[model samples]
Target chain A: MAETSRDAKRARTAQLILEAAREEFATRGFDGATIRGIAAAAAVDPSLVIQHYGSKAALFAVAVQLPSNNADVAADHLLEVLAVRLGELPPETRALVRSMLTVPEAEASMRQFLDERVENLAGSFDGDDAKLQALLAVSGILGLTITQHFLKLRAFDDVSSESLLEAAGGWLAPAKGDT
Target chain B: MAETSRDAKRARTAQLILEAAREEFATRGFDGATIRGIAAAAAVDPSLVIQHYGSKAALFAVAVQLPSNNADVAADHLLEVLAVRLGELPPETRALVRSMLTVPEAEASMRQFLDERVENLAGSFDGDDAKLQALLAVSGILGLTITQHFLKLRAFDDVSSESLLEAAGGWLAPAKGDT
Candidate 1:
C-alpha cells in the first residue's frame, strides 16, 4: 500500500513539475527562464526537478511539441491525415502558434521545423517548381490550422468533418501539368 | 517656378499624410486612432488632412485597400486572377491583416466581407455542404494571401510567379472529385 501511494505521489509531482516548466518557458522564453524559478513555481524542491527531468533544457524538450518524426510523410498523405484529424486537431496548434508569434526562440524553432518538413514535401515532386507547389499546399494547411484552431472563426470551427476533408482535398493536391 | 514648387509641395504633403495614416492605422487600429493625431504625426495641419481626405473614415477608405468591386468576383475566377497577380501582390495584405488583428471593427468588416463572398461561391455548388465547401476554399485563398504576401516566409517569397500560379491551381478550383 505504501509503495503504490508513493508511486502515485511521484507521478502527480512529475506532472505538476511539467506544467510549471511549460508555463515558465512559455512566459519567459528559453534564455530568460530559470530552473529554480520553475521549481519554486511548481512548489517542489529544486533538486526533485533536476532528479526527475535531468535539466531545464531536457524539461523544455519534453514539454514542448516538436515536429513529429511523422513529418516525413509525403504532402498528399499528410493533408489526408490532417483532414481526417480535423475533428481531433491537436491542442498544441493554438499554443504553439501563440507562443511562436510571441517568443523569438519558438518562432525560430518553428521556422526551422517547417522548413525541413516542407522541403521533404517538395522533394516528392518532379518539376523545377516543386518546392513552390509544396509551399502553396502548405499555405492551405496553415490557413486551416489558424482558422480552426488559433482564430477559432465560427465559419471554420462549425464545419462538419467530412466537409472539411473535402474542402482540403480541392486545394492541397498537386498536378503534374500544374506548371 | 513658384507654382510648380507649390504643386510638388502639395503632392509631397499628400503623400506624407497617407503614409502617416497608414502607420497610425497599422499601429493603433481604427477606433484607437484619430485624424488630428495622424496629422500631428505627419507634421501637417489637421485641416490639411481633412482638406485632402475629407474625414477620418474617408482617410481610412483612401489609405487602406479594400477589395475593389473586384471583390464581387466569383471564387474560381478570383483565385485564378489573384494567382496571376502574385508578382504584384497588394501592399494592403500585411497592413490589413495587422489592422484586422488589432482592431475589432476591421476584423468584423473583414469577416462580413468574406462571408458575402463565400456565400457567392457557395451558391454555385449543389450540395447541402456548399457553404462549408465555400468556406474551405476561402481558407485556401486566405492561406495563399497570407503566405504569399503577409508572412513573407522565404519558402513562399522565393517562388517565381509562374510557379506560384501553377501551384495555386490544384487546390482553388471548385470540384467534387478532388481525390
Candidate 2:
C-alpha cells in the first residue's frame, strides 16, 4: 500500500501528545494532571487527546511501559544496567512510579507489570521457591530505584556504580546462584 | 507536683488529634490532606490542631518517626525484626512514605532520617566504604519494606515470614560479616 501523508501526520501528533503527557504526569503526578493540561502542553486540542487516547488512564498506560524483556537481563547484567538505571529514570516510568502509591489505577498497572516481571524471572530458575526468590530480587531492584530516583538519597552520591555493584554482589549472587 | 485535671484533658485531646492526623495523612497523602479535615476526624476545632501542632509539616514530623534506634538493631537481628517490619506499617510511617516522593518536605525529612540511619549503621562497620555498604544494606531493607508494605505484592502473602527471612539471609549475611 502507498504511504499516506495524513497517516504520517496523525502518528506525529500522537507522539507529540504522548511526550507532553509524560512531562505533565511526571511533574504534577496522576491526580494533579489533567486532560486539558496535557493537551495544552502538546499544543493540541483537548478533544484531540481524547480522540487519540480515550482517557487519562489509557494515555498513562501507553506512556509508561518498561522496555520489553527488562526482566530477562541475566542477574550479572543487572549491575551494568544498574549503573544506567541509577541515573535519572525516563519521564514516563517516573510518572508511573511516582503516582503508583497514591493513585488506585496506577497501583493496579504497576502491580500487574511487576508480577509479569517476576513471573518471567522465575522461569529461569528451578525450585518451588523460584517465584519467591525472583520476587525478592525484583524487590531489591525496586528498592534501589525508589531510593535513587524517588528519595534521592545523598549516600548514593558518594559511591560509584561499580562500588555499589560490588557491595550488592554479595547477596544478589546468592539469590541467583550464578555470576 | 500533683497531676491536674486540666493537664489530663489536654493530653488526651492531643493524643486524639494525633491519631486522627495519622489516619488522614495515610489515606489522603500530604498534599491531599487538610487541617480542617483532620480536625473534623478528631472531633475538634481546627484551632486546637494548630495550637498543639504549629503547622501541617510540624504535625507530620512528630507523627511519622521510625522507632528510636531502628537502624541500631544489628544486621543479624534484622531478620527477627524483619518479621515484625514486614507486617503492615503503622499509619504514621505509611503516611510519611506515601507522601515522601511527591511532597518536598516529606522527601527532605525522609532523606535526613535515612542518612542518620546509614551513618548509625556505618558506625558498626570498618573501612572507608562502610557507609556505602550500610546504604546498600538499608536500600535492600527499604526495598523489602516498600514491597511488602506499599506494593502489597501477592508473592509475599504466599510465603511465610520465616521463609522470607531465611531466603533473605543468604545475601544479608554477607552484607554484615556476622550472622
Candidate 3:
C-alpha cells in the first residue's frame, strides 16, 4: 500500500517537472534553459529534477516528443497535419521548433523528424526533383504553422484552416505536370 | 587631425560592437542574449556598448534590420526575395526569426514587416481570400528559408534555389480560380 502511494507520488512529481521544463524550454530554447530553472519553476529541489529526468538532454527529449502521426503524407494527410499544426501548437512541439536552429540537440531531433517526413513525402511525387518538391511543400506548411501557431500573426486569426488549405490546393496537389 | 582620428576610432568600435551583437543575437536569440555577452564578444565594456547602442532593444533594431525590398510582391519579386532569403539568411534576420515567437520585441518587428508584405501581396490577388492567400504564400516562403538556411537540413543542400522556386511555382502564382 505504501509503495503504491509512493509510486503515485513519484509519477506526479515527474509530471510536474515535465510541465515546467516545457515552459522553460519553449521560452528560453535548449541552450538557455537549465535544469535548475525548471526545478525552481516546478517548486522542487534541483537534485530532485535530475533524479526524475536523468539529465537536461534526456528531459528535453522526453518533454518535446511530438505525438507521431502514422499516416502517410498524402494530400488528405497533409491537410490533416496542417489543420492540427495550424491551430494551437502543442507547447512541446513549439519548444522543439523554436529551438531547432540554434541548439544542436533540438536540431538533431528536428532533422531526424523532418527527414523521415520528407522521405515519406518525396516518394509520393515523381521526377528527379521529387525530394526537393516534397521538401518545399513540407517546408511551406511548416512556415504556415509557425505563422499561425507560433508567431500568431493577427492577419491569420480570421482565416480558417479549411480556407488556408483550399488556397494551398495547388501546392498540395501532385507537382505541376506530373498529374 | 586628432579629432578626425578619434571619430574614425569611434566608428570602428561601433562597427565591431554591431558585428558582435549580430552574432550573439543569432546564436542566443533576443531573450537569451545579453548586452554583457555582446560587449564581451566585441571586446568592449558593457558601458561602452550602452554608450554606443543605447539599449538592448535599440541595439537589436539596428542589428536585425533586413535590407528593405522596395518592389511590390509580384511573382518575379517573390522569386527574387526567395532567392536571396533561401541562399543564406542574414544573421540579423535569422536572429529575428529565431526569437520572434519567444521575444515580444522580435515578434513585434516581424509582425510589422510581414503584415506590410501581406497587405501588398493581397492587393494583387482578386477575391475575399486574397489576404489569407497572401499570408499563406508568404508564410510558406518563410518556412522554406528556415528549413534550408537556418535549420541547414542536409537534404536541401543539393537543391538549388532555382529548382526550389520552380517547385514552388504553384505557391507563388496567384491562387487558382483567381485568374
Instruction: Give the winner by DockQ.
Output: 2
Q: What share of the true interface contacts does each candidate keep?
A: 0.43, 0.62, 0.64
Best by lDDT: 3
Name the DockQ score for candidate 2.
0.57
Instruction: Name the lDDT value of residue A129 in candidate 1.
Output: 66
**Model 2 ranges with Cα > 4 A deviation:** A1-3, A67-86, A127-129, A166-179, B1-4, B54-58, B67-86, B127-129, B167-179
Q: Lowest-lDDT window of 10 residues in candidate 2 chain B?
A: B77-86
Please list the residue runs of candidate 3 whose C-alpha ends up more than 4 Å from where it truly belongs after superposition.
A27-46, A67-86, A168-170, A175-179, B1-5, B31-46, B67-86, B175-179
For A75-102, candidate 1 gives per-residue lDDT tens digits of: 5555643344455544333334434433
Number of the candidate with higher lDDT, 2 or 3: 3
> Can you list each candidate's DockQ?
0.24, 0.57, 0.56
Ranking by lDDT: 3, 2, 1
Model 1 residue B122 lDDT score: 72
Task: Report lDDT (Cα) of residue B157, candidate 1.
Answer: 56
lDDT of 1 by residue, B46-69 (tens): 999999999987777666665643
Error at B9, model 1, angstroms: 13
Candidate 1: regions farther than 4 A off: A1-65, A68-84, A88-91, A99-107, A126-129, A152-159, A166-179, B1-18, B24-41, B44-84, B88-91, B99-106, B125-129, B169-172, B175-179
User: Over the stretch B1-179, how does candidate 3's per-residue lDDT look in tens digits?
Assistant: 99999999999999999999998998888777899999999998999999998999999988877655456445556545444335565677778777776666877778777776776777777877788777877888788877776676767867776667665555556555321
